[model samples]
Target: MKQTGVAILGAGRWGKHLVRNFLAHPDACLVAVVDPYPETLAAIKDKYNLAPEVRLATDWESIRDLPTIEAVVIATPAVTHYTIIKDALNQGKHVLAEKPLTLDVAECLELCHLAQENQRQLMVDHTYLFHPAVKRAQEVVHSGCLGDLRYGYAARTNLGPVRQDVDSLWDLAIHDIAIFNHCLGQLPVQVQANGRVWLQFQKEFQVSQLPVEKEFQVSQLPVESSEDNQGCSQSLTPQQPANLPYGNAKGEQPANLQPANLQPSTPQPSTPQGLADLVQLTLSYPTGFQAFIHLCWLNPDKQRRLGIVGTQGTLIFDEMVAQAPLTIQHGYFEQNGSTLSLLVNIVKFLISNHLNHFIQYAIAFLTVSACPNLHQYLLVWVGAQLVQILSCLSQSLHQGGVPVTVPQLPK
Candidate 1:
């Protein structure tokens, strides 16, 4: 096999994982590792025992124009994705960028156009899409074993590694969004989002060692009580005034015991302008399938789990479950002549009209089930999706700058 010369940009954190994977692949040749930090480059070089042929550069510009390099794997921050990917594509190099192709949707579209024009492969590193558990789930869905996918819910949370540039949505939920799109074989038509700011600090703050009462008092409420006061009943009641204009016989306000005007001794710095630490998003698909994603950076324990619900069965993928990460519970409801006979009759009538459609669906289900290698088919399916996007973009390009219909899966 002809080896593809590849250069990896950014050598810190996740970049090192990409470096190891690319190096392990037989078809890839690590030509260069680029980063602005010398310590990272030195660490990577020493750990990987990089050959003299592999060039280490402080800037990507040094390797972007090199003809020897046929591909660029970008693992830098989301903000730098646009410039680095655009430059790599412009240089006729196949580009694989980390998720959220670009911070802005317009930039993402432009990069796709550039890649199409250059006839290069433009892929986003939705690593979960390649996971064995996720692949199995996709197979289960495609096989119609779960019947019709009604909805999906994903929760991805961790305690630390809070990013300042992008919020929990872009940093964490994007993975689940991509996975949902890939598994459902469609994109969301509408999305609703809600988020909250739990922490004002830019860096991750440790709350494990600090006393819970003290931390909560400092961050959340202005509780003016001594450490000896174990509960609110002990301290809050005595702090109330003995007599009040709108107080009851017990001297407590009829409405509620409102806290006095208590403020922090020192005003904490304002929260930096950045993404939210907690975000909840609900996506609606044209097929009437809905997905809910919950992401948080301040969670006590790390969690990565997805649940898929259908009429026939339920599928769960719990990454934390080491013994059995993927599980399917068979379930189905049979409609018979009961108290709700009228509803059952109506459902039967509706299903009768769609007999032909159901037959075609059944054929597809059997075809998928008969396939010996589902993983290969999934790869081809993903590739086909990419090709479809490129084809649409190429048509748009030929039509003189009309907008291209980008696919739902980030890239």
Candidate 2:
């Protein structure tokens, strides 16, 4: 195997993981780790025992000046992707970048074009597409076991934590969008969606009927109660919560509460109830195959599950199960609705229990094998699917639940 010198930009969480993986890969030489944070650079140097020759630079100038650095893996923020990737390609280096190639569509297109102009490979790190269970599901879908593709749905959500700079769609939903595109091999024609911001300084919620009823009741609550006092209760339904003045008077508007005084009492509209803290987005394909994606940052469980339904059968991939089986249901909805069955066990093939199945697959194909071209092609698929998913999602956020068409990259 020919050794390729690789440099990792960003020593943050994901960046460190990439650094560790590349350091362990026999075919890769860890050229450097770049980050602006001094602590991050010191931590990487101490934790990984980086060689003296492996330069740690805080700026792009130093990175470009490194001797014999042939490639760069960018784990920086989306805003910096266009510049960094453009520079890397211009330098005649192959590149792998994290999702959301760029925050702006025009910039993303420019980056792609630059890569082509330079004849450099521009790969996106969409981890899910390489997942063992997802891979199994893709194989089954292509095998005709699922019959004619009908509709596919997925949800990735949790309410426990919110991001500072990005929305639920970008932070989490992007993963499923990539998977959706990968499974369907096409993008949605149009997208219309509604979103709400809650629990953050900035909020963008969907406009819905629930807000009308809530606003009516909040107006009836104590006039002095600041909206902040009502912020915690915003998650409540029309039925007033306990310990609040509105709870005692059911179905009766408080007589003392006046519309004028209601100015302070009237709550600011936030996200909608039952909107899944995340979302369940439906993607329509020209072939009549529909895909639904549900993502949440609020679910109590830490599990990623995917289900694909076709005209003849169904496929389920759950990460929690011991074997993480890629179960298939064939002849579904038949005379007896066919039968429930476990089709295959793809998780065991993973290199270890600690590493994710997808990472293992990438490592296997990229380093421990002779399938360089094959692995490169897979990276391209991951990148293109990611671009489509996010594009549709952006459309959905702008439009009102209108379907959006996903675009394809030129071969």
Question: Relative to the true structure, how large is the alpha-carbon lDDT of every model?
Answer: 0.55, 0.56
Off by over 4 Å in 1: 201-274, 333-411
Tens-digit lDDT track of model 2 for 1-411: 677778877776567677888888776788887776566689889999999999887666677856567777777655456678888888888777766565555566677677667777677666766665666666777788777877776655432333323445655666666666666666666544455433232333332101211222323333221111111111112343322211111124435435464232222233332222355577666677777676655454555666787767777765556464466776645343576544432233232243354444554443442334346434444565455556566556645555566666555
Q: Which digits, one per residue and each the tens of the lDDT, describe model 1 over residues 1-411?
A: 577788887765556766776777666788998866576688889999889889998777777777789877776544456677777878877776655455454566677677667777666655566566666678788889777878899888766444333345545665677678778877665565555555433333221111111111223332232211111111112333422111101112223212231222332222212235666667677788988878776665667888888877777887667556777776676657653221111110011122233222222222232323433322223433433333332233233334444456554
Which candidate achieves the best lDDT against the true structure?
A: 2
Q: How far off is model 2, as Cα RMSD?
A: 12.6
Residue 14 deviation, candidate 2, in Å?
A: 1.0
- Could you tell me every candidate's TM-score relative to the true structure? 0.65, 0.72
